[model samples]
Target: MIAKKILNDTFLIRNAKVEDAIQMEYVQSRCYPTLHESEILDRNHFANHIKVFPEGQIVVEKDGIIVASASSFRCDFPEHDSTFLEETDNLWITNVQIPNGDWMYGIDMGVLPEYRGLGLSKEMYKARNEVCAALGLKGQIIAGMTIGYGKVKDQMTIEEYCKKVMNNEIIDPTITPQRSAGFRWIRPLYNYINDPESGFGSILMYKPVDENYYL
Candidate 1:
């Protein structure tokens, strides 16, 4: 696919290249400081993603510098599984990518602080959706962090917090945007990532491919 610029050529969104790994790593570090070092994917992981499912990995660039990125890979899970414990035990892309898996699992996404409000995050999700449709995948899934819940956790439980966010009673810096883009919460995942503020939990979300989606 041809790389396209958005917002009057101020930003460009395109498939990630192996050489872009270093910048992707930088963006991740800047975006998620509270996350443990072990939880963050390194350059090697990003390279592996390009080698495995290049189409599922995307990056956004501003004036030729990488400023945002999203990573995903295909993985299969039991349709009846409620918790996704076994399905997500190893959230790393290299460890979990399944060649024939029917669903695209979003592993990481981030945008630099300075690039916020420029629609970069939404473009990354749209890229993922396009990849899903291209591969004929059933849907896209994300173990999304409740990044805004830390401030309210003292007042309510995690489940309650998610419900409020879903009902528009609250806004999550992370989940709210995904919900607006058509994803819906499926359940809460425990130990989903090594995040301490959110108690290592994430809101599992999914968005089905539209029946008429085309390449």
Candidate 2:
């Protein structure tokens, strides 16, 4: 399905197509360089995502250039896993996606450097939330990396850092904006990703679908 257009038609958000794999790869590389090479999705991975769950992937474009994207999939909460980290090994979309699952697992999102300030990330999430409501999914979940925490890790613990970001006392390049978009911190996830600032940990977050939320 096509997502609602934003920026007065200056930009558009739509479901990912197999043709977008190359641009998606470029954006993923530019956005998360710290991640190990094995964790980055390749062109075939993108095709598989579109093949298995088309509505779960959303992309933004402006002047025919892809600028940002959000990729996700449906999965049930793994009750046996202690931390969300256990459920994210290798960060492969195929390993976790379950077609009949109740929750929407947010895999990753990115916005190219030049397009950072236009609120594209927020718009893409709005589109994702709509998909959740339409699919009758419970809510969106993420293992959110605290990319900014690397700077202050020596001064605080990961839990403390998340609280500060949520309280608005600090701004995490990633977590803070996610909170603004409606996700709330549920717990700390150890070894969630390879990001150094977060000490390889991240915050497990959730945002229940608000049926009344509108663009």
- Compared with the true structure, model 2 gives a TM-score of 0.89
Q: How much is the lDDT of residue 122 in candidate 1?
A: 81
For model 1, the superposed segments whose C-alpha errors exceed 4 Å read 78-92, 211-215
1-215: candidate 1 lDDT, tens digit per residue:
42788778788999999999999989988998988786777788788888888888899998889999988889875354333334533434665678989889888899999889878888888778888888888788887888887887789887788778778899888888888887877777766667767756788888878835322
lDDT for model 1, please.
0.79
For residues 1-215, could you state the per-residue lDDT of candidate 2 as single tens digits?
86667988899899999999899988988988777676677777777788878999889998878899878878996554343334643445677778889888887889999889889988987788788889988788888888888899889987787778767899888888888888877777766676776667777788878745321
What overall lDDT goes with each candidate model? 0.79, 0.79
TM-score of each: 0.89, 0.89
| Runs of candidate 2 exceeding 4 Å displacement | 80-89, 211-215
